[model samples]
Target: MDAQQVFALLCIGFVLAAFDKKKEHFPLPLLLLAAGILCSFVPFFSNIEVTRDLIFDWFLPALLFVAAYQFPYRDLKKDAGLISTLATIGLLLTFILLGISLYILLSPFLEVSLVACLLIAAMLTPTDPVSVVTILKQTGPQEAADIVEGESLLNDGTSIVLFTLMSTMYFESQQFSINSFLIDFLLVTFSGAAIGLIIAFLANKWMHLIKDNEYHIFLSLLLAYISFYIAESLQVSGILATVAAGLFLSRHFHVNGDKEVKERLDGFWGIIELLMICLVFLLIGIAGGQQPYISYLYYILAGFLLMIAARYIVLALIMYLIPFWRHRFHFQDYLILGWGGMKGTISLALLLGLNAGGKNSEVIFTLTFGIVFLSIFIQSLTMYPITRKLKAQEQKKKESS
Candidate 1:
């Protein structure tokens, strides 16, 4: 879609949000998606197009930055270990297991490369915890919200790294080496984070010099965009850079900036976030409706099922192996973590970047789209019920004691 069309859709998004004031009918994102789907039937929206650049260049950095920024520093510090483990080791496990299972499942029915399967798995690896975390925050069990948000923020970097590596392997005919992969991963991840840290450090110093605290928002906006641009230009993880910059700047502002300015900055970013989320989800529905994958119905269902199963298996494995995690996060928490992992715009952006997988490229795209659609549609809808159930269980236990 062109800029005008995008802006039009965004206007519709705002209208939809206003209509869903109580959220009694549906979550805001899902409601927007439904609206977009209905709009997709119109002849004007028939050829709705979304490029990787359209999303990554326009939407991703700001959304990532705001999510990271709004996340509480204290919560992040407390759950740092668990979040890191899930983002790294847990992500890798899910990728491997899902990739292998997908290869076996699809091999009999379709001609898809191993790297392509891995790429699909990689696309699904990073969770979008926004919807679920919002529900958890409104309900009880704040720790689950913290861990889910923190893990999602970090895993986007690692998932992008994996996606890039797999794309290279498939497109360039390069072989995977454990040593090289590890080295490259470390370099991209750390370098991106380092760039963010450096930029944030300078920005924090600059923030101090500014007499008008109101202007801090401008600096933050520049920091979010510039850090991501520089990191991507340097062939590092732009997602990580934005996340790091967002986290650092947010902590700095909260700890030292004027209360009024902090609130102003938050209000500013909140608007940006709302607009982005609305447009993105609406676009997701429009994009999904553009393609008729009726023939891939079984494959889509199987792929989504496998993805959820893989996530649960990985989380269960982690809890089983780590006594600390087992004690700290109970069964219900893990269930929430597993189901709450929703895939969204990032996955679609990565899917759009697929250019070299021949016919399998289209197949992978459809599968990723289907899985993401279901993940957001189903997982997001059920999040409140899950949290409510857990809250009741906790209350009942308290009353018994």
Candidate 2:
């Protein structure tokens, strides 16, 4: 399908999402995904593919920017230690535990290598950003929302870097060394943050210099892609760079700009955000058709199970380690966080970067895609109920007090 045709489909998907959003029972993303899968069967959309280059260069940075920009920096700052622990330390622990389990359980059944297992774990490590405002909590607990959203934002970068590290080891046969990995990890993360901060600072300054709001929007766009490209070129985490830039720019970006300019920029980004969400999930659904789902059923099931177990274990440890975790968080809070850790576009995008020569590429793709489907359908679908349950618990405790 051509660009125009793809745009048409995306528009339709957005309409569907809007309608689905009205229905409390229907999960918007899950509906979009289902619609895309059904559309994939149509003869008109058979050739449509979500290319990796397109994802990295354009859509990814934009999505990452908007997410970071929209996220409340104040809340993130308040939960900085908690968020940082979950995003970095907790993420690695999840990857390690999940990877080891997948290796032990699936190695005998599936011929995938240890590196492939590590890659899978990395893909599952970060909570998908698709689930920003849990539909279940119209006015959810701010603390829980803060931790969940902050972790999702920061962990995307960590997950991207870890995925890259493991992919290099698998594809290039790079010798795996913990010391070297630690250096690479630290360098990549810090460099990405530094690049993002520098770009955001410079770009925001230039934006203010411009008299036109149109130019301001244009510069914001430039900042996103430029940060990503520069950081990637330097062998750092471009994902983090884009996110950092977004967070920095939006944190300082005030609503008190020239009315027309503010409106125009908001309108532009609003459209971009809607279009990205629609197309990304639709593309996910479309991609699923090409896979051999039945063959990897076992892998999909096992991976999903292991992922849930891994998230639970890591969150529990983190909660235990932190002195005040119980002071603010309860069992339902942890449950929501664990289950809300849905996998989405980024996970699928990283699979495309996997070595084609790697063992069972088709199987990897299928399992990853299947797991994503489960995450959206199962986890996201249940988030609302969990939120309500937690809210009720909070009310009971307050009344008793």
Best model number under lDDT: 1
TM-score, predicted candidate 2 vs. hidden true structure: 0.92
Evaluated at residue 347, the lDDT of candidate 1 is 84
Those runs of model 2 whose alpha carbons end farther than 4 Å from true positions after fitting are 21-24, 133-139, 254-264, 397-401
In angstroms, the error of model 2 at 182 is: 1.4
Cα lDDT of model 2 by residue, 282-327, tens digit: 8778877557778888788888999999999999999977779866
lDDT score, candidate 2, position 148: 76
lDDT of 1 by residue, 1-401 (tens): 77777788988988888887656226787788778778788777777876788788888888888988888888888888889999999999999999999998998998898888998999988887555444445544678777878898888778887888898887787899889889888988899989988898999889879978567889989999999999999999888899999899778866786678788888999898888888877777787765556778788889999999999999899877888888887778888888778787778888888883455667887888888888878877777778878879988999999
Candidate 1 pairs with clashing backbones: none
Q: Which 10-residue span in candidate 2 carries the lowest summed lDDT?
A: 131-140
Where model 1 places Cα greater than 4 Å from the true spot, the runs are: 22-25, 129-140
TM-scores vs. true structure, each candidate: 0.95, 0.92
Whole-model Cα lDDT of every candidate shown, in order: 0.82, 0.79
**Candidate 1 versus the native: TM-score?**
0.95
- Count: clashes, candidate 1: 0
Error of 2 at 353 (Å): 1.3
